[model samples]
Target: MGCDGGTIPKRHELVKGPKKVEKVDKNAELAAKWKYCALSQEKLRRPIVACELGKLYNKDAIIEYLLDKSAERPNTDAVTHIRGTKDIKELNLTDNPEWQGERRSAKGDRYEDIHCGMFICPVVGLEMNGKHRFCYLQTCGCVFSDRALKEVKTEICHKCGDPFQNTDIVVLNGTKEEVEKLREKMEERRRAKAKTKKSKKSKAAESASTPSEAKDDTEVDEVRNGSLENGDESSQSDKAGSSGASRLSSSFNGGVPNLATSKRSIQEMEEKSEAFKSIFTTHSSAKRTKDQTSNWVTHTPYHF
Candidate 1:
């Protein structure tokens, strides 16, 4: 009998049941990774690009992120390492021959294949869906499956015939070990390139600093000619001064001055001046004979 007013609880509220495990949709996740931009989460279109981590993105989305990095976006951490356009490479994708895009399944035909891929490997008939492991060549931007490459065992691209190395093949959405191997190869190549650039810069600097041997020879010749001309000028000045003194003596006293006496006086004056002493050795110091005080003139009218 219902005596008091009470609410009847539903079976879900009254009875505790096991927690429901979140069901992960595999198809949606695969579509998001293969057909959408990694950075902007938009549908992948033409002019697609990929990073070193093998994530696909639209070129326009990367450009917008680079132009204004401060803008808020859903996937900021995914593209923080991308500094410029050089950080990414434009992908050269081959469309699947069977892919109809909006044409094949627009009317929801029951006969249309749901497993058809938008892109396919030219080397093998395998599709690029999540069911198979795929990789792309960084050097040539050609996509292929890991199985096709291993089975064919060729160093040249099957699609374009471009030669490629082991390091150039980068697996898309690869395992941890595969990504690590790719990273090491990329670092090694960059280091080698930097070393070559540094060597070229050093060579350029050395070439710019060193002068030619011809220039050195011309500089030495100029210095020798300058010293010879200075010696000639000094000798001419000494002769002119001596001649003037002798002419004044002959006019005033009717006698010519002694040449040796005039020469000794001029030498003493030159020794007192530092400029003459710097140019030549003093006459008194150079003489081998004893000092002759009687021949020397202590006082002279000409100060120079």
Candidate 2:
């Protein structure tokens, strides 16, 4: 049978003696006649198998051949009364799952040995050149192999219908939980990077503004000091001019020469004071000092 519709609760009749399940190939029977199934005459002896599938795989139309062989598969089962192949189906499980109604999860991997229908395969390890893979399917049930688990990780199995999940579990099928965790990790990394970038931008802005702000404060302080100095100097000049005018007025009244030039002199003083007012500007201290030191000779007449 077919386990198609409902759970049939089918029971496998237990047999007290070894039963024979005849597969299609007479050659297999000839080669494996010396060995018997575990439930057969020899359960304790070294397991014997006739790897015929490896021989037929190279042909271009392998599916057609598989279908034809599958017809023989049932007959083999009926004759030998053995369970089906184990978890070593080759096709993608979702598609082409059954080649002539044989499941990869069938009890035996009777079909996996076919590699272009090559010669009989060895029962031992078969790994790729890169040491990344080794076979441990129904043809070989995680048996006497070096680093059996390692082999399963990289190899395909006939029992579980999927690549071996190391020797321990064959179907370690990809789960939704793992995929979700990976997505969460990626999102977390993205958020952390964004936070770091934002903080760096803020720090850069602060650093860039600090010097400009300091320079502005220095300029404002210098301007205020210059204004204060100008006020003091202007008051002193005004007082001196008033005293000179008063002296001129008294001297003229007390028999000195009629000094009409006093008024003109006071006007000239006012004009000079206005001109000097502009010189009290808030020049940058460094520029002012550089000019004064470099042009000391040019300022001799004015300074004196």
Candidate 3:
């Protein structure tokens, strides 16, 4: 009721309605705070996008976002490119849409700026004013500008005035935990893929430069050696031919060589024994001839 009511009766102020109005206003404000203006979401590959977006974390975030959730919501635009040989029509009949990319200068959060930007950031900017935009990104070399740095909560680029289709807000659907987990998994896969590529590239380089490049299986044997009895023929032949060799060799079993060898050995030994006996007999005979020729009684004939 209004206090300035006409003639008949003075009306009281409606305290209750005003309180409700204030509550509504408060509620609207809270909702507006989280409201996102779907201005732009341009995408690019890391170094490629980093050049465009002003830092590395922003690049990494965009990459992680697209890889983890390829489905673009109403406010989002997708920028994906396929490198496979399969054509769009061949890949998926239902979703053959070749995705276009998006870009933003919301630039990124402190996460991006800290890794990509200048000497002073919002965190440090709060500490000191008049800070320039610079790269905290490991790759970003210099502070580029002070103007591009922006607050995520309040200030939005009015370039987003056109409502493409604002009817449905995604309601921040999906858990932050799931998103983070997805990001971690994607990063792991990316690392693994990169490592594999690096290894292959290194191998290729070595092969190109050095034709005799060693393979990874140098220590492994080609094939197992045969059993002791079935070793190389050369080794077997040498062992059989060595001095002090076994008389019981395979060839000696029933061979002409064995008979000849036995005969020759016996004949040689017999000849040596006969020659020794003859020498002894001849020496005894010669000694007897000398004894008879030198007889002392014959030399002195008349004495006896």
Candidate 4:
């Protein structure tokens, strides 16, 4: 069939072919992964953190997400694994001296380098612009290029000098296989921590369950035995006589001890001087008869 205006029909326009797969720009993908946050998709600022899966994020973005997970966000899937601050580690990044940041070109005259990274490896001086593989130590949170670690070969962190094992190294923006391995390690660590907590709680419970009364009784028995061994026979006899009197008084008035009659009054002590005895309110000299005593009203509105 031909057009109404006598235009020639093309065979290419008549037959529709399969849709071509749209390819993402490599530079933009690199910038998104290395320069921007994985969760917020904003520029990665200071105090950057990474999850167990090695996805980079701005610390504030992660905090905001954790504070309200139910809130509407564009990238909730990227942060579903992060339950709290403990799930992520704040990175100790080394600044790239060559990177002038956003202040370099305001007039647009100077050529801006898009691949330039804000941070660099402390050991090998490699830029962290997604061009090279980078990893951060879980123990120290120090970032270092993969080449530096493989070349140097040390158990200690190159930046922070803290000791770390191979398992502690988590790849940044890692492949699917690497992420899977990291997740396994994370699960293992969590399981180990839970076991330790349960063991500690059990130990605490066992300690709490021990009878404290038995210890108190043993201490009392030791004290009594020590007193019996130290004192003479005459003192022991006097103590026994006092104990028999206290027992007889306790039997008369249930099991409660009659402290008033069992203990001597301070005012009636034979060794106390009359001056000292007069200071006490219970002394006979301090007593007032009914006629001498006034009404015990502390305060009254009516005056006599």
Judging by lDDT against the true structure, name the best candidate: 4
Name the top TM-score candidate. Answer: 4
What is candidate 2's local distance difference test score? 0.39
> Poorest 10 consecutive residues of model 2 by lDDT?
50-59
Q: Estimate each model's TM-score.
A: 0.63, 0.25, 0.22, 0.68
Candidate 2 regions exceeding 4 Å error are: 1-192, 246-254, 258-304
Per-model root-mean-square deviation over C-alphas: 15.9, 22.5, 21.3, 13.0
Over 1-304, each residue of candidate 4 has an lDDT whose tens digit, in order, gives 4588888878778888889999999999999999999988899999999998999999999999988888988789988888899999999999999998877866878877889999999999999999999999999899999999999999988877899999888999988898899889888999999999999999988787676767888899999988887776768889999999888776776555454557878776677799898777776766666676568856432321
Cα deviation at 142, candidate 2, in Å, is 34
At residue 64, candidate 1 shows an lDDT of: 93
For residues 1-304, write the lDDT of model 2, one tens digit per residue.
5657875653454335566785687445322322232122222122223121211011122333334544433123312321233212322111111222223455565755322111111233332111222222433443222344443345554334445443232211113564355345435755898899999999999999998999999999999999999999999999999999998787677444454653443233443555454443322221344444555455523231
Off by over 4 Å in 3: 1-52, 55-64, 78-209, 213-270, 274-304
Candidate lDDT values, in order: 0.78, 0.39, 0.33, 0.87
Separate clash counts for every candidate: 0, 28, 19, 0
Q: What TM-score, to 2 decimals, does candidate 1 have?
A: 0.63
Instruction: Write model 3 residue lDDT over 19-121, tens digit each, in one string.
Output: 4333455434322221221112332222322211111223444445445565544433322321221101110001112221133345456332212211233
- Model 1: per-residue Cα lDDT at residue 185: 70
